[model samples]
Target: MISHTSISTVASIIQLSVAPVFLLAGIAGILNVLAARLARIVDRARSLEMDVPTADAEVQRAEIRELAILDRRMTMCHWAIGLCTFAALLVCVVVMVLFVAVLSALNFAVPVSLLFIGAMVSVTLGLLLFLGEVTIATRWVRVSEQFVLKGKPLYDR
Candidate 1:
């Protein structure tokens, strides 16, 4: 019983929803990267944890310090993942509201705009956290390498 006008409206709504759907795909890709980094961090942490107990005193202290840095990196990565996931969820809601507004014959422009803004903010923060995590990991590696190259062992051989 749908008229041509209704079909056209639905088509327009679908067109409008395309950008957000693309955004969801982008978010999924970011999530995949974040998850992979988190996995590597976890694996490294586990290996360090296993080595900590039997390490000599100097090596044990260094391992503990490294573990602390790893813990902080893990926390930042976790938050990034959470924020990005939230952003994706908000985008989904925005798309749903767009279609619901059409069916209910109500204007949802303000809510849609607000939801999109929230999503952007969340994703921005998520990326910032990811950057922070990467920076810490890179810095730690540089320090460890410098110590090793200068005739100081950073870990037990």
Candidate 2:
């Protein structure tokens, strides 16, 4: 029973919602790439430690410092991604609310309510994943710091 104009309005609202979702997806992809690079850096640091002579203390220290810098950069990237993800999620919530409002106004027979609920759940899951990544990056940074300052091996207890 909804008029054509109402349906078009709903479509427009949904279209507007896509921008934030796409932005978040892009940010997430960047973070994933950064995480992989950090893993590689950790592996290279380990390899360097094994190859370096213990008597060459200055060289060993320099390598450790470099690794620590990489870790800090990774942590910063992780936090930035986490913040972007959180903002995108907030935008998603607003979009979902607008969607529901438009659907109700149209009085469409379709169960668009379920779609709105699903969007909310998906955003929640995304937030949780971002938080988990942040936690991991923070631990990695801490380990790198210990290695640089105390001569401890990475991941040491």
Candidate 3:
């Protein structure tokens, strides 16, 4: 039989775990976005591969360059996803440690704090990698470049 005090302690632990749970949700969302970006990058690379063989030399060169950039973008997105997942795992461990410490009547402050700090650092690095991937995507490829003809507007009046 659990005492009222034990119930209250469990309630307190749940309350303390709420913030980390929210953080996990946010990490999952970021992971989804990163995975989508990676998929798109893969698709684009595949298309470029198919187009390369029949393209003119100049166009093939450009496609190769774009493929290289896409590769970098894919790498960055992969790293971001990995780091965010690790952060989410760390958060889970932190929450578990909190519950274990409370139930076992042990002091786990240092470990929990360290795990939380690691989670923050991992998430921060993941976000930075995401930003880098986005930057490469926007900087290396201009949408208008696709619409232009040989030194002229795609559609002139």
Off by over 4 Å in 2: 1-6, 49-55, 104-157
Question: Candidate 1, residue 148: CA error in Å?
Answer: 12
How much is 115 displaced in model 2, in angstroms?
Answer: 20
Score every model by TM-score. Answer: 0.90, 0.48, 0.91
As for TM-score, the candidate ahead, 1 or 2, is 1
lDDT of 1 by residue, 88-121 (tens): 9999999999999998899999999999999999
The local distance difference test score of each candidate is 0.96, 0.61, 0.96
Task: For residues 29-132, write the lDDT of model 3, one tens digit per residue.
Answer: 99999999999999999999999999999999999999999999999999999999999999999999999999999999999999999999999999999999
How far is each candidate from the true structure, as Cα RMSD in Å?
4.9, 10.6, 3.4
TM-score for candidate 1, please give it.
0.90
Which of candidates 2 and 3 is the stronger one according to lDDT?
Answer: 3
